[model samples]
Target: MNIVAVTSCPTGIAHTYMAAEALEQAARDAGHALSVETQGAAGAEPLDPAVIAAADAVIFAADVEVRDRERFAGKPTVTAPVKRAIQDAAGLVAEAVRAAEERSDTAPAPSGETAPLDTAPAPATKVTEGAGLGARLRQWLMTGVSYMIPFVAAGGILIALAFMLGGAEVAAKVNGGTFQGRTYEEITDLSALVEQAGYAGVLFKIGAIAFSMLVPILSGFIAYAMADRPGIAPGVVGGLLADAIGAGFLGGLVTGLAAGALVMAISRVKVPRALAGIMPVVVIPLVSCLVIGALVIIVIGQPIASAQQAMTDWLDGLKGANALLLGALLGLMMAFDMGGPVNKVAYTFGLAGLAAGNLTVMAAVMAAGMTPPIALALATVLRPKLFTPAERKAGEAAWLLGASFITEGAIPFAAADPLRVIPSLMAGSAVTGALSMQFAATSRAPHGGIWVIGLIGKPGLYVVALLAGIAVSAACVIAAKHVGRAVPAAASGAAAAEAPAPSERAATVA
Candidate 1:
């Protein structure tokens, strides 16, 4: 069999490439030829047309909409979430083969028109709605986080740069008297702040504008993920209202989900042929926005705002051991499964706190998250013989990935030896989180590892906490390896030997 597949996820980081590698290996193991296209945030590497034409079946393992899906029109198709491909690639391929055989024998539709891109076998709606309630909620939240991250990175880094270039008061200086009491748009005299703060003033303004869009973008894209194009406008509007009403990130999440579900329900309404044309463009947006906007403003706004304020106050009130304990808990969660659902839950919690103006939680979470990869990298450097040559090389790459705060860098190591690796990672992560909290460290940006150190409230302490975790984790892994070699070498060596080489593991998981 010849197979063509496309893999994607909302974040376009881990799952996309993991699924591709899994499919390729599974195909090879099954004595079939497979070509995979990865559509990710880094961009798409599309499959050749010749490969597509020769393919017996197509598989779409995605969490986001596939681009240029028309290319697969009329192909026997199997669609599943990207995680399924990673976990059971062989099964998916087998299913696709059967689907292809059935397709080959079946008669075509009488009209002879190819099914619409979205109407392919296993439509996205079925894929999402078929999942258990918990899975569906996680998927929705992750969709929002994935879309919100780019804005956070850009805005956070820019703001950090502004502070680095100027003094700590750069924002105040830029906004205080620069425009002579005029608004940013209405300010005609750019010369005033330019003369006072130089380029820093300009950078601050730009970053502030970007920061302002964070909530709206999160809400809009969440809706887009849920209801496709029709959900965008209302979602954004709802987010804006959330912000205006001081409902914070939690409220933005609610608005995004509510707007998406409302629009999806509205889209299913029966309508005349004349009205159908305008439903998405006109009726959907108009009705969804009005309904969502009214509900948010009249019923939801004040209560959510009060809750946000109370949460912020509680976070602010945290001191000493209370903060450290919270940080430790968050850290354990982060390293428990690397980029899995447990890790995402911790990250989402941090993001929620950040939206409420509590940067300490984000600081602790990121520090903990970065520790596993860095620690593993350090371990390989300290004790190379314990790891395969391929793993040693992956460790070198892990340094960069860890420095960038891409926690998925550690996934390969964890997958190879979950029992030893995961526990060691969690220990180090907990230490890092506790120390960071103890020091009262804070970070303005949600992403970016060491590169955004300037944005951290206590840069020196943050680095110290990170280093402490790395050392602890590295030591733990080394000790685990040594102990395993002594106690379970005979029993575990065969399974370890059967595990794929480090390069293969990296390709599949990284």
Candidate 2:
């Protein structure tokens, strides 16, 4: 089989290349001709048109939207997340091959004026029959998140800068009335300090505007993922209504799904050839927006808003042990699978809360997420004799990885010694989470690990919480290693040859 594939992730870092490498190796082993394009932070290498034309099928293993997707418009395509390709490259390739065969079987018969086999490609139709409901839903959610992340990152970083440069009162200055009814422009002329504060106020206002659009963008893209272009308008409109009604992120999710489902249903309706061209441009967006807008505004809006408010009040009211318990649970989930679905779920929960201006949960999550790699790195240093040479090298890399908030850096250690390492990691992460919550730390940014510490509400306590977790987990790992049989350096090196590289198995978080 001839196959062409593209792999991308939101961060366009490790997972993109990992998936590409995995697919290439799998294709070679399976005796298939393959070309893969990796879309990474650095950019992409365009696939040769000849190769794409010759390919029997296309695979998209991406967590973000594929660039120039129309290039594959007439091909049978299989889509999955980049992690899926890394974990099951061979399986995915095999599925793509099967999809190609199905596309061939379903192709329209050749007309009287026949063309050569190579010249006549099958009509473009995505092959999603193999994707289960859960997979599809996950893909939709991830698509939304991938699109929404930039807004959050930009808004958060800018807000953090405002707090740092303009002091905490910058928001008040931007609002005008709180600064003795003086406009920001007038305040800037008052004094040097006031001028600096005015600049900060500008940053705050811009960031707040971006932050305000986060939910609506998330909703729009999620609908686009499910029903393509036609779903976007309705989804955005519905999301705006969700916000107006105080439904929050929860409301955005509801509207996104509802809009996507409505668009899909509408797309299935038969239309005359003359009207078909205008359907997507006019009928679908108009009818779907009206239906979704009305449903969210009149029927479900108040109930969802009330529920959201109740949840917000509960989170805000959590104190002492109750907050600590919730934090610990979040930490455990984040550490349980490194960058897997469990970790994503925990992270997503934090993001949702952050969108609602509940920063404590995000702070706890980030703290917990940073613990595993750092703790393992500390353990490797504390007891070098217990670790193999390869483990020690990986540990060295983990220092930077952990500090950068890439939890997958600890994955190699955990994969090698799951029984002992996992429990230690969970223990450390939970401790960090609890401490962060107890300290009432808050974070505006969704990512950037230790690099964003300056943005933390209480940087001092956050550091203490992080260090405490690292120390506890490091101690626990050291003790566990003392009880277990340690592999000698030479034997461990020989064993490493038989297994996949640790980097290959490590998942990426964005």
By TM-score, how accurate is candidate 1? 0.46
| Model 1 steric clash total | 0
lDDT of 1 by residue, 1-510 (tens): 999999998679899999999999999999999999999987898889999989888888876667787687657677776888999999988888876675565454222121111223333222242233433443354445545544545554566567666654465566653221232332336767577657887876776676566667767756765776678899999988876775545567778889989987887677998998888778999999999899889998666556545544554454334888888888997898664445766776787666667889989999999998889999988887676443565577677667767675675466445577889999999999999989989987666677677779999999999999999999999899776233221121212112222232222221
**Where in model 1 is the C-alpha error above 4 Å?**
1-147, 175-193, 246-249, 272-277, 309-462, 466-510
- Model 1 worst lDDT run, 10 consecutive residues: 488-497
Q: What overall lDDT goes with each candidate model?
A: 0.70, 0.69
Tens-place lDDT per residue, model 2, 1-510, is 999999999678899999999999999999999899999997899999889989888888876557776566556566666888999999989878876775576443222111111111110111121233433454455445445545655665566567566654576565443222333432433345435556877777777677677668767866866776677899899988876775545467678889988998998788998998898789999999999999988898666556545544454454334888989977887787675445766777787767667899999999998898889888888777676555676677677667756676665566445567878888989999999989989987666577667778999999999999998889988888765343322222222212222233233211
